[model samples]
Target chain A: MRDASRAASGRKVCLLTGAAGILGATFCRRWRHEYDICAVYRGGRLQVPTQEEWFIDPLSPHAALRENDNPVFAVKSNLREPAEVQRVVDLALARFGRIDLVVNAAVHVDRDRLTSLASSSDLLDETFAVNATLPIQLAAIVCRQFWQHSRQDNQAWGRNVINLSSMASLGVVAGVGLSAYSASKAALNMLTAHLAAELAPIGVRANVLAPTSFPQLVPTSLVADTVVDLDRSDLTGCIVQLDENGLRETPSAPSALHF
Target chain B: MTMPEPRTLQAVNDLQPLLQARRWRWRATPFPHIVAENVFVPDVQEELARDFRTLYDQRTTAGYNTQHDFLGTSLISTQCGSLEVFISPAWYALFTRLFGINEPGFLTAGVHRHRPGSRNGFPHNDIFPERLDVGPGRGDVLRFGGPVAGKSVRAVAILYYLNNGPWAPGDGGETSLYWDWKDGVDTPVDSVPPRDNTLFAFSCNPHSYHSFRTNRKRRDSVISFVYRGVDDYVQLWGDEGLRQYAEYGRHHA
Candidate 1:
């Protein structure tokens, strides 16, 4: 609703992750014009059909929802793969000229906290993947490809990494079987801070979405709304949330969710 | 470097009459948009899940958050069934024409078997984003969702099935999509009869009223899903998954 065209102009193309998700989907829809969108997501998962069925993007689920007549190639692959990650960056550059904004909208949910001894492996793997490892990997890859490491640590401009971390990364929702899950998110918070400090010098911003949905689940689309604001706000290293008022909200607690 | 596939919008355009009929009710909406569509694909694999009973074993007053409807856990699990009742390539193809593209989907789906004799959910638009970008006079999407009374353009509720049998007329598992009351008038919308492995959708927003009757006779089962266009993708893609997955996020130690 707010006019951000002035701020949006002259920015380099954007590179997005988790494009098929509710948050990712919403982001692509609302912010497609703000930047030349380069959306990504996990590939080849069998999506249960909805009306969304007709628009499957062959590359990734997020890419499947684009409305532009412009050709959006679905680079079918996973973010976990370093080689695959590198390939995605290359694809973006080949399509556009350069990448400006990097939004980490990708997330994997693991819910077996008080899981049985028999299910501990599942719990551990899920926790690690959802909690810490993926974000770390994403940051590493983005830094290698996009960051201008030679810039002053404090005064970098026009570059940022909007990571999709969670409120779980900060506090407790008190759900059953959530010990590992909670611990993992908490670790993500620390990772965000570390990455933010390290990435600051490279003229890149790193922020997280530490939402406080105590008795309920917040939508990924809500998080995407925050990313759309990047064109206007000085929200570098900030984590935004979709609050009760149907608008993007700031974290009640100081530390946001993603790096 | 690798090339990615072009993303396309899956506009649910086969729904002209069904949608148009409802749109006839509103003169204020510039244009109405179908924000969600989930069809039950029949002839697919099926299962019977007892997770709902397990979840509700000791937890009563089942409403969990801001959008609580009834007082009990409303959940269930359905096993494999036919794809005939679920969506087919034909329906999907129709969606393509509406959306102007071909979007691929899969054959696997689960079921929501509400607890036996459970009360229906309180009336609400299924997808509510924490932040809606809609404003006055843009269209119907900005005006949809909530218990009632606010301006909402959402007009249909689509329910698909897990099996190939007809639900008894008295199964009590009807859906309510619209309801209203005032000093001078009162109207309510309700769910159509239950069917096995089939997809039935309708509107219940602003003017298209509807609701689901309680399931008191036989078990109430549904292979639930929803859809939206590229315009409303964020609301669906962003917030819709939490309907089930996020609950798993909140478990006690």
Candidate 2:
């Protein structure tokens, strides 16, 4: 539940999962002023910097906005369950009355190899549930709300859903046991494309930003910038790959079971 | 060592008049360019398309800068047997006669593939005469003595589309010719779609400002550069350009 005593603000609301992760934390610290964030984390609490600790440094390209107190509303929830994902979406709406962006940054990377595939079935199932299913459920929930609200409001702004993915979804990562992780991310990429195509008529856009390099090697700010760029632009159904050079669009590989 | 069939050469020869007729100046500029459709016979077009597909599949490396994202490879890499069809002495003689140049000075020849969401190249002329330097250890520099004296040799570029069929309107990946830059805007004068077997040729000059953008579908083409006086051309963009091209050539080699 939101603290009703905090004044209802007119800023756009962003429901960001994995708020405790490195990329998510950087986004929260940088975009707090531009968005009223509903920060959702699964395991641990996110330690956001206070105003005294947060100096007036430029956070992003849209960093000119003045910072406000307690722009982020942290919610603790287990994303594996469908009910908990719904709660995160409901909490954002209750807190800000509108959800403009959904950043599905949470991921479950359990190492498993093809040789031990049968032994790792449980972990594979859990990985898919957390990484792929949760994102789709959250998108459905938010899109439903946006559709209902737009019927009454004539000037509804465009809503955006950004799914953070990895390059392993497109190509094999050498020497890494990522069978489950790769499958989950590949499915997530497809979900993003499907959502973009279906939701475009309703003014909702979806895209996947998969970094070609390791997450730690690529700057978090670049990821943040890509998210902002995708949000602001009218591009949909794009699978953009971030590398050392910059962002480039990659083709979605075909599924094995083609009917 | 396979060559284009005699019928293919005849068909291409038959389109010379149409290509010459399509030549026009953009926005009163003296830049000469021609876009001809159905330049090659169906069999040759199919062969080129197959070669490009094989190259695209075997492409292990690609590079991107601010200007464009390109998959650079050669016939040597793909090991396609149709190399002689594109670089035959007869074809060189035909181009020399068609363009009425003194000699066919082949500069660079390779396959270019741009997949969906690739960046559009910026508007710029291909020739940079002022940047050319014939210093020690540098590659051979060709000197022009006639009307183009003191100026570095200008080249003519040919783009042969290897797409299997006609492209839809606004499908992008079309080579765009610009008239001039106005208020930081690239004013497009004409655009040639990547139609099957279509060929676009133009002289690389100061007035030759052109760009290309890839659409959602893949774009494949064979692009070759030919200079008038120079036997070979080397684009020297200071040390950085040299280093980048050396690395690029090494990777694609």
Candidate 3:
């Protein structure tokens, strides 16, 4: 049994997108002990509830762990709107006082049957906007407003932005119907790489986690643990892939173009 | 001109814990300065912002340069009386404690309204060679009296931003800090936007070069300077080097 109020102050705060999704909820439930999660969702409701009911059995081995306290803050905001994005960041900062990590787990998959025929320009645009553009926008506002001038000395506060990517982005999944989805996720990967390169000097990390498939080959808990590991490691500008063989990393190539 | 609302003693007392809890960590690079975010609590922040908007809408006059206009008030404007009476001593004590100054000091404060699209201003450090007609008492302001002997040295400068609305990226009113005036206005070591209820302050030195960036919208802030007497000035940079530094600032300004 953990005390929620007491533990919240010492725990790092994570602003997680896609809280209603499987991976996002799992991450929240699993790491709610280590972090106070600001769970963000657009459509569906976040499934994790507070510690109201407890399943205690005297005969069970894990009976001592029956009592629980959840430290998840749920917020509904459409990331497509820049104003909504700013509001979400502001609310999180107001509640938690600081956000040490950002998890971009929100995804958009085009459902139009005509997407395979390359006829859905609007669908592609919306998908790209949500997946690629929104992440950068959120990153920019949070970095500028929340981080401020305090991180100037390159102090490793473990401040990071982690994007959940699909293996389809890496061309491992082949389907004409998934073209828009794959392209947008790939753009996110590259954008994360660029963001990582730019923010490295300031001691802020950005990386991507490319899973072969959620809950299919990779268990959701493994993916969550991998996020924690990636955040803890010194690695930046690398794509860590999860598959049957376990995690493998591919470092991003250095860019020749300088601003 | 419509008058601004005054900040009450109750407001200052309400903000005491927040200000006390804030760690005034001074950074040394570019220049010695401290940046404090969320400087006031929500209600006080809102009230101060409203007062600034009232003053800007009614009282501001034509600017000295094309870059910014002025609202030349006393050491503290009667409109925002609590800023000097109740709030400024907090800052004065903090700066003096940080610098370990044991002697007496004074402050000069005014409101500045930078016009939108007015981007062409030279970088300057506010260390003029002229003597401050005001004496060594707290809250004394420069009255610009007839020729006096010694220089009035500025020890610290603080800018409290009081914008009420949201400040977007493209609607840029940023206080650009530079490593040196030779670096030009384009290359700033750091650019602090005029965010609502934020405070940016720096020690006054020869290398403390700063200027405004292109503001797509109007920029408003309360600018205040903490000063020490001529003895401290002569000790820092002898009487001889005063004119040289002043000339350098004048040439750039």
| Model 2 per-residue lDDT tens digits across residues B208-250 | 6677865767787887655543323343222332233344334
TM-score of chain A of 2: 0.81
TM-score of candidate 2 restricted to chain B?
0.66
| C-alpha DockQ of every model | 0.02, 0.00, 0.01
Predicted structure with the largest lDDT when compared to the true one: 3
Tens digits of lDDT, candidate 2, A72-115 = 78786888765887788888888778887889998888786766
- Identify the superior model by lDDT, candidate 1 or candidate 3: 3
| Runs with alpha carbons beyond 4 Å of true place in candidate 2 | A1-10, A49-70, A148-156, A251-259, B1-253
| Candidate 3 per-residue lDDT over residues B1-253, each given as its tens digit | 1212323222323335434224333344567665666766666666666766666566555235532333344435345533443235555555555555555666677767776766655577766654666545634363323123456677778888886368987787788887776678877766777887777887777777787787788787877777777677678756644554566655755
lDDT of 3 at B236: 75
Which stretches of candidate 3 lie above 4 Å from their native place? A1-169, A172-259, B1-25, B57-72, B75-79, B85-87, B135-149, B237-247
Question: Candidate 1 residues A1-259, lDDT tens each?
Answer: 2332232335456777777766666666666655667767674221222212223321122343434333233444576665777888888778776666677766666556464647558666766674577766766776776565534421223556666666565566666756676677667656666676677556565656655552255554555665656534445445454455554545423653222
Instruction: Please report, in order, the local distance difference test score of every candidate based on alpha carbons.
Output: 0.45, 0.62, 0.68
Candidate 1 vs candidate 2: which has greater lDDT? Answer: 2
Clash numbers, per candidate: 90, 0, 1
Candidate 1 - CAPRI tier?
incorrect
Writing each residue's lDDT as its tens digit, candidate 1 over B41-73 gives 111213211222343354444543222223322
Q: Order of all candidates by TM-score, from best down to worst?
A: 3, 1, 2
Please give the range of 10 consecutive residues that has the lowest summed lDDT in model 3 chain A.
A52-61
